[model samples]
Target chain A: MKTPVYISHPGLVTPLGLGVQQNFTEITNGNIAIQKHSRTDIAKEPFYAAMVSEAAINEAFKSHGAISEYTKLEKMMLLSALETLDNSEVKISDKTLLIVATTKGNIDVLDKDSAFNSERAYLPNLAKTLGDFLGVTATPVVISNACVSGILAVAVAKRLISSGGYDNALILSGDLVSRFTLSGFQSFQAISDLPCKPYSKYRNGITLGEAASSVFVSTIKPTQFAVQVLGDGSCNDANHISGPSRTGEGLFKSVQDAMKEAKIDAHEVDFISAHGTATIYNDEMEAIAFNRAALHGSLLHSLKGIFGHTLGASGLLETVIALEMMKQELILPSTGFDTLGVSKPLAIVETIKHQPINILLKTASGFGGCNTAVVFKKVS
Target chain B: MRNGALFAEIDAANFEGFLKQLYVMLDCKYPKFFKMDTLSKLAFMGAELLLSEISENSSEHKRTALVFSNRSSSLETDRKHQEAISSHGEQYPSPAVFVYTLPNIGVGEVAIRHKLQTENAFFVFETFEPEFLQKYTVSLLNENKCDQVLCGWVEVDGNERHGFFYVVGRNGKWKHSAATIKNFFEHD
Candidate 1:
């Protein structure tokens, strides 16, 4: 029999709040964090984004280390990972692996007036900084596959631990809403003018968000609220460089493979945490993929409406929230969703439904035509 | 260049020119080759050289995975995107340049070329960690995730470029181990 991996101690630092419980509370209370930001330094015109409060991050980071010494993304990652470390019995050692996931780390360092050296923009250096902060002896592995980096980190951790390469894995994922990403998204004309309404006909585009989330995966199970990493699949659309597949071919195959490995059928999945960025093509693509996987009737929700699109952090942050929902037996509504917009039908959670979520599917798709689906089961 | 015999060499003035010369020598007909950044071009060429030797069965292609690592993490293309939006330049970032900012686009390019939709991951490290790569790839094969894996270190930063790619399968002549992989990464 293969070794089973268990996940616990979810850590989060998002615009809603710090720590998993705080963010969960905010989401449960119908709070949305995406708002108008008129920062001239990041963009020429005002844009809507979910930004973590600098003051809050500094205040919470005071007990950890010097605030100014670390970059903004570093501070978020450090705080989130420290939460998981503080709560879990797992220790950072040679036997433990650290995986850092992000699209752009310390990207602000490339700005003309940045305080840090430009070399900090390199992902390996950024990961090493986090590893050094946490006193990890083994070389940290970094994943930078666009938005799927966060959830893909979980899948990587599961594989590494199952391979007996490590006793425990601490997965930390973070990204920033900096001038680089904001300008890039603006260039694509993909930034939503309003808070994104995923799967709604009136939805315009994605609302960029920034946050960091961490989770610990190990063979040892926590005393309470532990979830088993059943199976995972990541596949490329192999069709486009930047756009998702029009037919949702990659996502369909990913979900099918993941479920096949989990030895479960579509009817067994109680809920799905979807990657609904509210863009027209993305939502439509997801609808088709879910329908193709025979998951049209599965209860689904997108966390983007609450936290916006956290980029690298979105997948893990949303997964963390899904775990909490499983424990609480409450399925949060897909905020900002009104009418079904996609061609196929999706059982979008329109209201809070208190139901036992045994098996859940978490999926994320991103640039480079990458899609990842991971199946998790609540350990009773 | 087969078996390190140096069968061909191109005397070009610049890196791009050298890549173009190599493309012509290989007689590649793919029109999309011209649009890729330096990193993608290098990865595509390396993959072409390695994958061309494999069987042409389309069914086997779905069982092939690509695991790549790099040091720079698309910084060369990122520099261009940054410059386009910088105050000293045009201040208009092109979506075409912006799309190639992630390192995995190269992996995506190769996947599109070979129609391999199995598994893909791009890792960044300070240097090539052969042990980690070997362990990760072996686990994937052992777990029945894929039948074959294209693993390598593809790094490109401005004028510096290094690509080492090899296919790992159950029936390879050489044993798939860290030491052997390291030997190829260093000597080959």
Candidate 2:
């Protein structure tokens, strides 16, 4: 028999707030954190983004006096992981693995006029630093699989713990809103001028965001409300390098694979945490995929409107939010969604529907034509 | 049991030429390869080198998982993108260069080339972890997540590139064990 993996001790640091209670309250109240910023470092023109303020990070780190050696990205990840680990009984020893997921780590160190050595910008260095801070002796595993990195990390951790002798694994996902990332989105013309309207008729593009989220997947359940890691799958579109498949073939296959592994039918999925980046092609593609998969009846919402597209952190952050939403029995509205946008129809969660949400499916697709789907069951 | 194996290393001076030479040697005509960034190019070359002979009749191409890793994580392309912006101005960040900034683009490149739409992922470790790679692949294969795996480390630092790729399949010649993976990874 396969080992059961349960998710517990969720910790998140986003523009919405810190911890589950604060962010959940703010998001449930329909308070989105995205705002227009004219920072010269990011861009000369104003850009909309959900960014965690430096003051907030500094304030959060005030309790840790000996953190001068860590970079801003490392600090954010460490803080998020610490919060989650604090509530857990699992020891961070050789038996416990640390999986750090990010699209870019310490990327700012590569900018011109920066004093830090460029090697420090490597992802492994960032992972090692955070793992060391978490008191892990084993070498850390870093996942940099574009936007899917966050959710994929959880899947990897689940498999590792289930198949190996490890009893616990911590999966942390993070990315920063740096000048490099912002300008890259701008270059692609995929940056929305206003708050991102995911799955909306007027949706333009993604609003870049930054945050760090952590989840502890253990063989032993730690809480009554622990979420079960049902099954997961990842597939490549094999169609384009930067664009998603026009047919959503990768996404369709990913959902099919995940559902097959979860041993659940499409009708059993009570709700879905869609990627819903709000871009025209991406939303259309997802709608087609869901419809093709016969998931037309599943209530679905995207947290991108509230958190923006958190990139590497989006999958895990959205999963964490989905767990909280399930715990509170609140179907938070897909903020910024006004009218149906895609060609295929979807039961997009428009209002705060207070319905029982169990057996949730979270899906994410990224630039490299990568698509990932993970199934989670709410523990009663 | 394994059908074929090959390893290739490229230096900065002959990187482009080496790719072209290998492309002709393998008689490949994929035009999109020329557009890939250095990271993708190196990974694609490694995949081609290992799977050139054996992957021909494998109907389960879609079932082949790519377990790739690197330490640099696209720093070379990052530097180029940064150079493009700095050398040009603040208003000009090349989207083409910007797209390759992430390290997993290498996995995507290999997937697109080989039409591998399976359980693909790119990990960044401090160094190559042969045991971890072998264990992860074996677990996935045992779980029936994938039928075959193309796993290895493809690290590109500046002009120098080193790649070690292995095609592990069920009912193959080589055993998919940790020690065998370490041997193959460290061989040549």
- Chain A vs. true chain A, TM-score per model, equals 0.98, 0.97
lDDT (tens digit, per residue) of candidate 2 on B52-130: 7665556655578998998888888888777766664744888999999988888888888888777888898887887
Point to the candidate with the largest lDDT.
1
lDDT of 1 by residue, A1-380 (tens): 88999988889999988998898888778788888999988887898999999899999999889998999889999999988988586666679888999988888898878889999999999999999999999999999998899999988888889988789899999989988888898889998888999999999899989999999989997776779999999999998888889999889988998898899999999999999999999999999999999999999999898888888888999999899999999999999999889999999999899899999999999887899999999987
Which lDDT values do the candidates have, in the order given?
Answer: 0.89, 0.84
- The candidate that wins on TM-score is 1
* CAPRI grade of model 1: high
Please, what are the lDDT tens digits per residue for candidate 1 over residues B1-188?
A: 54455747789998778788888888888889899998899889888887887886844456888899999999989888888878654468989899899999998999888887778999999999998898889888877879899886889986678888888988868998999988878886
Candidate 2 runs further than 4 Å off: A113-115, B1-13, B55-57, B88-91
Residue pairs clashing, model 2: B1-B172, B1-B173, B2-B173
True contacts kept of 1: 0.72
CA deviation > 4 Å runs, candidate 1? none
